[model samples]
Target: MQETGSADPFSLSGVIPPTITAFDEDEAVDYDRTAAHARYVVDGGAHGVFPLGTNGEFPLLSGEERDGVVEAVVEEIDDVPVIAGVGAPSTHQTVRHAEHAESVGADGIVVVTPYYYPLDHDAALEHYRTVAESVDLPLYVYHIPSKTGNALSLDTLDALADIENLVGVKDSSKDVPWLAQAIDAHPDLTFLAGSDSLLFPGLEIGCSGMVSAVANVFPELVVDLFEAYEEGDEDRARDLQSEVYDVRDAIKYGSYMAGVKSALPHAGFDAGPLRSPLRLMDEEDEEAMVADLEALDLL
Candidate 1:
């Protein structure tokens, strides 16, 4: 981790991919395939690449393997900020991962709130505080209530914002009003929209950018939305936004990573199927996804 002084850790710019992690046919972490996916997205125009994020199957990998992936991606990326996602149910493990990320060349760390069991306000605060204090690098609080069973409440955020190293947040909910209010209340805080379909409306308020899983397959589309908006081309921005929205709808029908992985090969990359318990789609579902992509001429 870069030495954190008074510098702001919140960097909200560009198309950042919560990139897809690939596994070989034997179900091992395919570093080459993972790096290839990262390169493909970056080459397609992503500002940076985030690995081991939720979309990258963070929960599915072992702790040691997670570190390996972070190290490999950092080595491969060279200059792009490789925001490593490092959070766990336990405070000690979370800190350990954060320290490991620091030892490597990770640009930042993304911490998800403890899940599997509900956390009260105090517990959540302590959980984040411990992790934040363990490293000198920027820490991004991940707020995805749908999967975590807990939202990063305003009260919790207020406390976290006080942490010297606490940089920003990645809000995955579709709640733009609440996110805008949060960004307004904390002007120093960098807010990243985690949903691609919400990117245009999000920037209209105060969100810096997005950490989109859809960028795994369509990085240019997401980046264009950001660029057009910045260039004052609202019409072009809306057009790109609509295209990604249509693709987003297709991925939501089933496992998103699985759907995207299936499309990757069609897009001319061999992103194999997902791990166990997250099986490849049945033939019918696969056909449905193909039909949707074909409709958009993406296939």
Candidate 2:
């Protein structure tokens, strides 16, 4: 088994938001607001920060913009670990991002599965192997099949476990059986539940932490849930989980992935606008969402 020390970056636990990339009104990346948001979550008790993940609009931003966001967050956060997302469709591009993340002093890197192309197990192993070999930092495999269209099977995971620097996985698969089985099968690799809906269940099943999108706007709620669980207050943790479900439902009132950006202003920070191709909530939807949040006393 690959032993992970308590001081290792892979020991990351608790709530880590896949932070949203703030953009100006004209849709340019806003580094100031973006870094401020990172500081907000870390100050609110997030264990770490993950910039340029799905919520951060990684695919929408150019490579330069992505590096800028990482640099800004790394510069702002001195206490918490920053695990920048460096996944791309090809091995070449993914390596470049991973190298840049290391160059900028990011604590770790999360590489999502290669997407857009259907890959065989051999191809998948090679892709991860090449990237893992290119960097010295801890590497966490990002398995979000719904978005990536490429899934990592347990057999392939077994192969990946042999890579020296490959330390953990952040699974957004939402398949409890798969997650549980993988956890059971690979005691050497740490697992993080990447979906908000499965936070409690994931903890129950052995996920060391969570990557909650809802944490972007409501870090305390998620952090409280994690702390409650860690402190052995299961009742409070369950209650918080129920509250998270309600918040999640309310956020879905708008377009896909727009809730966090829209709800930011209500939470006292304006992440500006999301890039094109993803729109914000309309007036009616925004009002309804605000009403729900108000009812929950989140506003």
Candidate 3:
């Protein structure tokens, strides 16, 4: 299979973590902590660092805030590709964000489907097509239906695979069969699993790699699983895959990004609170995370 990013040295393969955006007490963007977190994950073994994704709280950030986060991570990400999240409600916004990400030296951009208003297949196709055309960098289709309410059918994905700039996709839909089918159908397209739960099954189904949120807490483990799978060590891959789900469940404790952000403090990185409207973890939640980490021996 001609994996989407195979031609480029900065291929979007292996364990890529959508890094959390740290904030200060006043909920202001903390570039220093954000950059440190990026460095932490890369040093921990992430092949790529994604900023301003769902875990990074993109929808809640302002123009300056999001751009700062992207630039900060780009500065710290030395060799690994900084695939910045530039999804927005409109094509205009998405295009501008993609342009800005490119301006700040992001290796590529991941654009989610237009949310808030449901679009039919043709509308969705046109939207993605326009964004890919507007930017010079490689674009990845973020097929996360649960949040966006816009799931691309396998047929739509088939069409997208032909686009010159549409290089890869991250499947968060949780449909293993669909992901496998997409991978088989578009042998050249880069198929990346979106959640930690899909890590093992996705690779089994021929996915090139994954964009795991839990990789924030344990990058080495995620990288180990990918290496095991690539080396044909199914048993070791299964073991690491199981460990990742435990980490994923632990971080999914509080509301939205709170779990991951809260869990980072124990790993020696104090990822600040979630943005407004997204509540922080309470003391009880903290205790649960502590217990979970203790059980996992990650503490």
Give the CA lDDT, 0 to 100, for residue 229 in model 1: 88
TM per candidate comes to 0.94, 0.97, 0.96
Candidate with better lDDT, 1 vs 2 = 2
Total clashing residue pairs per candidate? 1, 0, 0
Q: What's model 2's overall lDDT?
A: 0.90
Candidate 2: minimum summed lDDT over ten consecutive residues — where?
1-10
Candidate with best lDDT: 2
Q: Give one digit per residue, the lDDT tens place, for model 2 in 1-299.
A: 12222323458778989998999999999999999999999988999999999999999988899999999999999898999999999999999999999999999999999999997899999999999899999999999999989988889998998888888899999989998888887766778899999999988888878999999999999999999998889899999999999999999987888799989899999999889999899999999999999999999
Mind giving the per-residue lDDT tens digits that candidate 1 earns over 1-299? 11122235445577789987889897788888888888899888988888877878889899988988888788889657778889887889899999999999888899988778888889988888889888888898888888888887787788888988888888887778788778877867777788876888877777777888778888877888889988889899888889898988776656645677777777788877687778776677777877898899877
What lDDT is reached at residue 273 by model 3? 83
Clashing residue pairs for model 2: none
What lDDT would each prediction earn against the true structure? Answer: 0.81, 0.90, 0.85
Residue 148 shift from truth in candidate 2, angstroms:
0.8
lDDT of 3 by residue, 1-299 (tens): 23455523355689889888888898998999999998999999888888888889899999888899999999888778889999998999998999999998999999988898987878888888999898889888888989998888988887777778888888899988888788888767678889889898888776778898888888888999999988889999999999987887887777876777788888878888888899778889888988998899988
lDDT of 3 at 272: 81
